[model samples]
Target: MGIVLNQSLKNTIITYIGFGIGGISTIFLFPYILGKTFYGLSNYILSCANVIMPLFAIGMQNTLVKFYSQCKTDEEESRFLSFTVLFPLLLSVPLILIGLLFFDDIAYFLTKKNAIVKDFIWLIPFIGLCMAYFEIFYAWARVHMHSVFGNFIKEVGLRFVSLLGLLAIYFKWITIVEFIYFTAVIYFLAFLVTMLYAFRIKKPVFQFVIPSNVKEILIYTFYIILSGSVANLLLDGDKIMLNQYMAIGNIAFYSVATYIALVISVPSRAMHQIVYPITAKLMHNNQHDELNDLYKKTSINLQIVGGFVMLCIFVNIEQLYEMIPKEYSGGILVVFMIGISKYFDLILGNNNAIIFNTKYYRAVLFLGVLLVLLTVGLNMIFIPIYGILGSAFATLLSITLYSLAKLMFVVKRLHLYPFTAQTLYSIALTIVLFLLFYFWQFPFHPIIAIGLKSILVTISYVYLNYKLVISKEINQVIDNVLKKLKIG
Candidate 1:
């Protein structure tokens, strides 16, 4: 328990540092350095590969993590690693060949009236393959319990390279098309680095024996692929659909707002990645009470983290929008919708992971598909009428409904609930603070105004927790840390 909590703290520290670097790259650098269209193109290419990579990888990644942890011997773990990589490769070859064969048709479908961009299509499989293996190798690392390196490589390393790519665009050294192609290379390089690191940490071997039979694994992968696809679609589906119904230009604006609001959701995501496998291990051992404790503590901790971020953006939104083009500010509504949707999920803590790792895992796949249909259904009904806001609402509805359904399912099956009295207290405190700060009419410089607003908000949240909801363990943890540093 101590080790898990420590790992969670270390990973949270690392994820935030990585996100700080990534925030500059996406929020500031992309808009400041590169033109919106080029950023849009770069975003599109990555989104495309994300959709393709999950399916092409054929769910090998999740299978690797779930099975590798269950494997009883080093030999079995080695075999599973090799075996996971094989299916993605085999599936990818035909996918690559098909894209090459029907290049023109594919281009026509994707680009329509726009000039043929199939040259960038080749980069898809190259990237798709790299992404496939990155997940496989990352799973390899995670099961080895070296979660930090793989996470950094995926989230931060790729973002770092893409940052440089945007810088090149800013300088006009590369055309929009060339920049998109470069994204594929960046993903491949990230994967290569992980593979090299894996070799340093442990040996990789190809063996035939894995935890489950090959037939059973293949069957499992087939099901989990949609689970992966639906999950990514919940994030990436909008961009793809936006491209289909609206102009490519629209994607740039939507992406910008999405990127800003997305910054607020990172803490929740970072915590989830660290907490997921631990929840699975606990469930495997029948530790329901421990799992429930984790669910509650993590929910409160993440709300403190995520709620603060959301409030910062909610308060500073007008100023944040001032950084981008006027047209992009249209994403303001989408930002709110997406922000709430994301925070709601964040507040759910490890509910999704608990369900995904349990005997009820297949239920998640059905839920994922349902989310896609809901997103698309709402997009169809709303995009023409409201454009980005409609998509925002549609996506919000999708995420909200999905979260509610999952929350209900987990409550019924696992008998867990993240929405404690503490959650209500946090919400009430945050709202009251926001109203006071927004209406107070501070007569000061904007920088001072911002600083004062932030301080007041923080103080208000602490007061609420102190008066009504501070957990004993959190206080104990704080005292121990202070003591270790010789502080009063």
Candidate 2:
């Protein structure tokens, strides 16, 4: 718990900083500098890459986490690591070859509704390759319990580079087209840096020896690929569907609103970096009681943190939209729909980590595939009728159903639940605060209004949570911070 807290705190700070940079880039630079059309194009390319990333990596990232702790000796560990590194090439090469062989047909299909995607179609797999390897090496670091450096590169370094790319476009150093190409290069650089850092953590002693559980490993990896694809598809599939059904520019609008909503999930993302491997280790050792304890703590603590974020975003959403261009303001509903879904996901804590490490993962993967199909069908039905709002609706519905299914599966199968009395209290607190502050606004500039409102909300939210003692861990964190400030 100490190490989880320590690193999760650092990762939270780093993730917020990255999201801060990304927020600026998304809210200010991207809309103003890149313009809506090219911005959508950029997002579309990345979304496509993300959607296909699992297929390329072949789930080695998650496999490494689930299986790494089982290695009995450093020799076995090295062999397992070697397999994680090299095994993806077996699939990636063939996939890339197939992509090339069918490139023309693929390009035509994707570009039928939005031709702007045609020219950058090649970057999808290229960037997906970079993203795939980055995650693999990132898992390499996570399994070694060295997640902070990798997290920084992932959360901050990449966004900072993209910020620079935007600045380059601003300064006439690169065309938008060149910036698009540079985006792929940025991912490649991130992959390179992560691989090096992972090596620095534990210099890879490459061995070709497959683990004794090769059959088990392969089966896990295969199911994970489907699960991973399902996850990515849920995250970015809306944008990809938007590209198919509407103008490319609509994605930029949707992206901005979704990015705001995305900030609510930052705590979960930060915590998951470390918690995942920890969760894997716990399940591997058959530590059921300890695992259930972790499940409860993670859920409540993340709810407190993520709920605060959601409250701020939801209460201040109107002003935040005011800061962006009016053309993008229609996504206000998109923000609400997506924000609720993300917050719902946040409260589930390490549910995903728990599921992925279990034997029933294959069953869950099948459920996920069915949900993906449902999502696509929903998008096809709703997008044509409701536009980006419809896409958001589809996402919200699918994600809610999927989350409920996962939660039920975990509880019914493992007999572990993530919620307790504190969970109910935390939800009530969030609702009370949201209702109290939402209708009120500072009569000032959008920046000042947001700042003042956020301050008030933060103070109220923290004080109430502290008084309620909704989570002992969270209360302790508050105590430590106050002690450091000599104000407790």
Candidate 3:
């Protein structure tokens, strides 16, 4: 718990800083500098790449996390690691070949409604390849219980790189088209840095030979591919699908709102960096009681953090949108819709890590595939009728359903649940705070208004939680902060 707490704290700071940088780039820089259409085009390309990343990596990232702990010796571990690396290339190479073979057909379909996407169609696979390897190597770092550097690379480094790219476009050092191409270059370089860093951490002695669990590993990887695809489809599929159903610019509008809402999940993302591999190790060692304790603590703590973030976003949404350009204002509803899903996702804690690391993973994979179909189908129907708002609705519905399914599966199979009376208390507290502060406004600039309102919300929210003692873990964190500040 000490290590988890310490590393999660560091990760939380790093992730928020990354999100801060990302928020500036996504919310202000890109849209203002590049214009909405080009911004949407950029988002669409990245979303497309993300949606396909699971397939290209062939689930090696997750497989490495799950299996790496089980190896009997360093030699066996190295062999397992080596296999995870080379195995994905087997799928990625063929994917590249097929993309080339039918490049024109693929581009036509993708760009039918938004032809701006046509020119950048080829960048998707290349960027996806970069994203895939970064995850794989990041997992490589995670398995070694060395996640901070990788998390920094992932959360801070990549966003910082994208920031540089946006600054380049802003300065006229690169044309918009060139920036798009250079974006792919940025990701590739980041991947190389992470991969090299991972090697420095645990220099992979490339053993091309298979580990003894080759059959089981390959089978699990196959299912993970579908599972990973399902996860990404739920996350990024809407942005890609929007390009088909609406103008490319709508994607930009949706991206801003979603990005704002996404800040709620930052704590969970930060915490998961350390918690995931720990969860994997716990399950591997059959530490059920410890695992259950972790599951509950993570849930409550994340709910507290994510709920506060959602509260801030919802309460200040009007003022926040005011800070953005007028064209992007249409996504306010999108923000609410997606924000709820992300908050729910946070409260589930490391449910995905739990499921993926367990033998019951295959069942969840089947469920995930169906949900993916449901997601795509809902998006197709809703995007046409509701546009980006419809995409938001579809995403909210699918992710809620998916999270519910995973929660139930974990409970039913493992007999572990993440809920408690405090969970209910926390939810009720969040609602009260939101209702109390949401309409309270200042007669000032949006920034000042948001700042003052956020302070009020934070004070009230933290005080109530402190009084109620909703989470011992979180309370301890607060106590530590106060101690550091020498405050009562």
Off by over 4 Å in 2: none
lDDT of each: 0.76, 0.94, 0.91
lDDT top scorer = 2
lDDT tens readout by residue for model 3, 261-359: 889999998888889889999998899999999999999999998998899889999998887899888999999999999999999988888998888
Residues 173-280 of candidate 2: C-alpha lDDT, one tens digit per residue? 999999999999999999999999999998999877878999999999999999999999999999999988899999999999999999999999999999999999
Q: Residue by residue across 1-48, what tens digits does model 1's lDDT show?
A: 465566666666776777767777766777656567666666776787
Over 4 Å off in model 1, which ranges?
Answer: 171-176, 208-212, 439-449, 481-488
Is 1 or 2 the stronger prediction by lDDT?
Answer: 2
What's the CA RMSD of model 2 in angstroms? 1.0
RMSD of each: 2.4, 1.0, 1.2
Order of the predicted models by lDDT, top scorer first: 2, 3, 1
What are the models' TM-scores?
0.92, 0.99, 0.98
- 149: Cα error in model 3, Å: 1.2
Per-residue error (Å), model 2, residue 391: 0.2
